[model samples]
Target chain A: MIRIDAADDPRVAAFTRIRERDLTSRDGCFIAEGEVVLTGLLQRSSFLIQAVLLAERHEQRLGAAVQAATAAPVYLAGQQTLDGIAGFPLHRGVLALCRKPEPVSAADLLGTAPADAVVACAFGLSNHDNIGGLFRNAAAFGAHAVLLDGRCGDPFYRKAIRVSAGAALTTPHAVVEDELDLIAGLKSAGFRLLALSPAGRSSLRQVRPAGRVALLLGAEGPGLSDAVMSRAETVRIEMAPGVDSLNVATAAAVALHHLSGRVEA
Target chain B: MIRIDAADDPRVAAFTRIRERDLTSRDGCFIAEGEVVLTGLLQRSSFLIQAVLLAERHEQRLGAAVQAATAAPVYLAGQQTLDGIAGFPLHRGVLALCRKPEPVSAADLLGTAPADAVVACAFGLSNHDNIGGLFRNAAAFGAHAVLLDGRCGDPFYRKAIRVSAGAALTTPHAVVEDELDLIAGLKSAGFRLLALSPAGRSSLRQVRPAGRVALLLGAEGPGLSDAVMSRAETVRIEMAPGVDSLNVATAAAVALHHLSGRVEA
Candidate 1:
């Protein structure tokens, strides 16, 4: 373990102004915050860790993870220096700079999945919280993968990773260039594409999946585009009259839960 | 419409330091933000509105609700004045202070529900986001009322109200002193009490509700107290192993969707 005494120390350049980096770019590396996320990052073999920065107080609490961090240099800093390095309060007190996995094509993600896998595909999911929640739900329901169209936010973004409770790190996901093309790829792979919307001929409770299924979700407002809805079977959650549709994440939770049940049946 | 020119106008006292007032005290009045929430508040017969403050620009857009506000006075102010009054930049540019509805006892809330009603009972739910999501789910699924123990946060709080998409205004809810006693009342009201827990014995997909049903949810961590869960029939959502349980609000959504389907059947 090495001690980081100064905030401007080049060793901690990646951790400076975390929020600005979050909005602009992480380059090829993603920042994982909090003990839970850092622990997950250390355990995963898919991502390579460049370094780990932790508040001095959390050193003992995260001893196991630090000991097993292999060759990654562990830097411990005082609370003030840590906050300066992060450009924020740094409440969670731990951060990890990780090398993002190599880019994998949407087709490759689908090609590698098992026959009865359940995957969540998002179209224009710009909200980070919604993206994180969807990944958390997908992981909770044992989904094989998550696919996002170009417009969706990065799940590896700081807030998205935190909101996902580290599930984004464990879940296999890829971003495709075109949404309609991704839908077509799923259809070609023998996966049933189920488009979830407020307007649909089928109720969610009544629909049953037979084999590999891909749940297609859209943004909260201006729901699934007509072109996308027309290409797949549409299913709606039967909500009380006059009520707006469920939040995208909550709806995905219900759909993932329902689809996961089919695999067991 | 009454024109309010000054930021310090006494009539707009409710609009001052809204974020601070939101935390310290709203007294018997709650601040509703945005056009959607204000619309719900204006239409509700149970609560009386004291005043409506709108940016000069929104007058044309909200013409009907503003014109038909009856006895309630509508105040118009410049965007800058509204922001100064709110102690923050008001993006929605609309605010309403409505008198909180008369408190109803847990017994009274359950008594008024129909024999087949679905009520969401929350125990120790202090987080506003979770409380808001639960209300939204309850409203979406046509639940009759929501009951909360004293440990829960006020649903009428500004952030909760907004997060609920104004469902907190439309849905009937009551808070009780004793959680255990509330559970007992639910039993006597001919309602099948289902305690939702991660370690529950029965899977949610297999559970069937016959008559009046109460879905009991607890706070995110340190789940429902043993004293409460021991009394109600325990039910769980089948999830992928190693993944943490669904967020409390998401769990409630899945549960409400399942129980509401029984009412239709």
Candidate 2:
């Protein structure tokens, strides 16, 4: 591990002002914060680890994980210097920069999915926390892949990655530019699409998943468009009177739990 | 409505430096921000409304709701003055101070629950977002009430109330000081205690809600304690291998969806 004595060290410059960088593009790279996410970068993700930055105190505990990333150089700095480089408090004490995987098409992802797979599709979901929660739920419920329309927030956003508990790194996903194209791709793939909405004709319990299924979720206030709902089997969760709907991510978990096929057995 | 041009107007003292006040005690009061929560405070909550503060622009949009809270006086200020008083930009342009509801015992809440009821119980959940998510899920699934152990975060905190989508204002909840007593109360009240844990012996699909059911959820990392699991029917959602568990609130949503009796029909 190389010691970084100065926050402005040329080798560690990429790690500086992280909060500001999160708002802009990272070229082809993304930041993974906290020990859990760092571990995911080194161990689970297929992405290339560009480098690993660690606070001096965390080196002892995180050394093994860093060592496993033989191709990436490890940079160590004191807590003060690390905080200066991050432009914020370094509570997690570990960060890693990784190359984003090459982009894939929605058709390619659905074409390669398992015969009886479950997938999550998001539309107009702009919240990073919701994006992260969707990935976490997809991972837990064994969804084959996640498909997001262009309007959804980046799953690799630093906060989204942390909120996802690093599932963003391991989960296979693709961002489709057009909603209509994504819908057509799912239909051609012979996947049953279930769009969640408060105005659905059938309740969640009434629908039976016969084969491969895809659950479509939209933003909280403005639900799935009529065009999207018209093509798919629209379903709604039975909620208490006067309540509009569940949080987008919470609704995804409940729907995925029922459609996962794990419940059938 | 009273016009207040100064940020330091004594009539709006309780609304000043809200972010700072959030860290300290309100002496049996809580702040509800955003128009949605403010409407909930005025129309839904049983708690008394102490006052309402609004930016001049919001008066036209929120006038009807504020008028309904006849007992509480409304104070209007310019956006600049409102921001100065809040110590931050007030994007939602609305805020309210509400008296906390009188503390109810776990026994009292359980005793009053409907014969066919679903209740969510939380243990050691210290995160405000998780606490809020739990209430939102409980409300979405038609759970009759929510019970949090003393270790959980206050649901009435500003962020919690907002994240709960104002469900915290409408949901009946009680914070029990002791987990054991809460468990005993559920049992004596003839409620089934289903402790959600990763190591649970039965999958969530195996359980059927007969009468009154209470779903017990713990924090994310350190889940329900062994002692608590021993007395309850430990249940788990079947997940993909290598995943620890879903977020606490997501888990509650899935479990409550199953046990809520809404699905049984």
RMSD of each: 1.7, 1.4
Candidate 1 docking quality: incorrect, acceptable, medium or high: high
lDDT of 1 by residue, B9-125 (tens): 999887898987788867788988898888877666524677889999887767447667647778899999998899999989998888887887778888888878999999999
Q: Give candidate 1's error at residue B163 in angstroms.
A: 0.9
Q: What share of the true interface contacts does each candidate keep?
A: 0.95, 0.95
> Residues A1-265, candidate 2, lDDT per residue (tens digit)?
8999999999988899999999999999999999888877767663478888998887776865677655688899999999999999998889888899888878888989888899999999999999999999999988999999989999999999998999988899999888888898899999999999989888888878877899999999998888899999989988878888898988999888888754456
Query: Model 2, B148-202: lDDT tens per residue?
Result: 8889999999999998989888899998889888888899999988999999989
lDDT value, candidate 2, whole model: 0.88
Task: Give the residue spans of candidate 1 off by over 4 A.
Answer: A45-47
| Candidates 1 onward: DockQ, in order | 0.90, 0.90
DockQ of model 1 vs. true complex: 0.90
Model 2: TM-score for chain B: 0.96
Q: Can you give the lDDT of residue A12 in candidate 1?
A: 92
What is the Å distance of residue B193 in model 1 from its true position? 1.7
lDDT of candidate 1 over A2-80, digit per residue (tens):
8999999999999999998898877789998898787777676424778889999877767446666667888999999
